[model samples]
Target: MINMKRRTFLKGSVAAGAVGAAVSAGLLTPRVVLAAWPSAAFEAKSVDSALDALMGSHAVESSDKISIRAPDIAENGAVVPVSVTAPMSNIDTISIIAEKNAAPLTAAFKLGKGAEGYVSTRIKMGKTSNVIAVVKAGGKMYSASKEVKVTIGGCGG
Candidate 1:
């Protein structure tokens, strides 16, 4: 038989009940938990506009320090694997952009101080286009791009 203490069980029950009430009352939403959502950046229609909205500037330097790993040809454009690796220091953010998508900015990730500059995720490709990786480090923006061919369109061909 397992030993269970009455006081311990009551404490856990109260904690759980408090959490459940907070959630049910919509007090524990994503916006409240996480950082502020960048709606303008995500809603931008063009790649340049998205970059401008996110990074506060559209001009980005092309750099060899950033590497993009993605398939040259995607069989299903719906879920194409993409990864970005930047072995540079002071990486603030990493953003993925699909050149031909209606809203070019696919994903953006914020990194903490002293964090490794690596982000991997699957993104939807509207058609055959360039997959661009923009890295923000030390208040400067650097970018790298690779062409990806999509066999089946994902975003409303």
Candidate 2:
């Protein structure tokens, strides 16, 4: 009975130690696990410019496969829900950009095989602007956009 209990405790300790090490090493960081952040795209002035920087010059023409979801009229600019979904095989990434916002690009998502090419989050809008969604699939770039009207300032307009 004592040996069995000791063995169980040792197993638990080893597992806990491994988890702690992973977390400390940043292997379990939110950004790592979530695979978010491609800052260059979000900071670009226009959708084309951002996509050029992110997907490179080899990118092809935009397609309708990419979808941008957002309210046509945002009652409040502070927290406007936005979602991007690209229905394409071998989708490498998805990016969101707010055209009129000060920062422009909002978020980027890197996806793996079998991973869903979708992301939903709230982005602040300085005023009415076009929210763009760019998706990289099979070494090509596809994009879509929708205009969102903001009632109150969110990005400090």
What TM-score would every model get versus the actual structure?
0.74, 0.65
Model 1 scores a C-alpha lDDT of: 0.79
lDDT of 2 at 120: 93
Residue-by-residue lDDT tens digits, candidate 2, 1-157? 9999788667755654554454446444432333345444444445544544455432446677778889999988888999988778888777788877655767777787689888899999888999888777776777888999887744533
Query: Local distance difference test, per candidate?
Result: 0.79, 0.69
**Which residue pairs collide, candidate 1?**
none
RMSD of each: 16.0, 16.4
Clashing pairs in 2: 42-105
Which candidate wins on lDDT? 1
Residues 1-157, candidate 1, lDDT per residue (tens digit)?
1346666556645654554454446554523332777665565666775676566666799998799999998989899999999987998889999988867889889898667999999999988999999998888889999999998734433
- In candidate 1, stretches whose alpha carbon ends up further than 4 angstroms from where it belongs are 1-35, 153-157
Q: Give the Cα error of residue 40 in candidate 2, in Å.
A: 4.4
Off by over 4 Å in 2: 1-40, 58-60, 153-157
CA shift at 15, candidate 2, in angstroms? 50
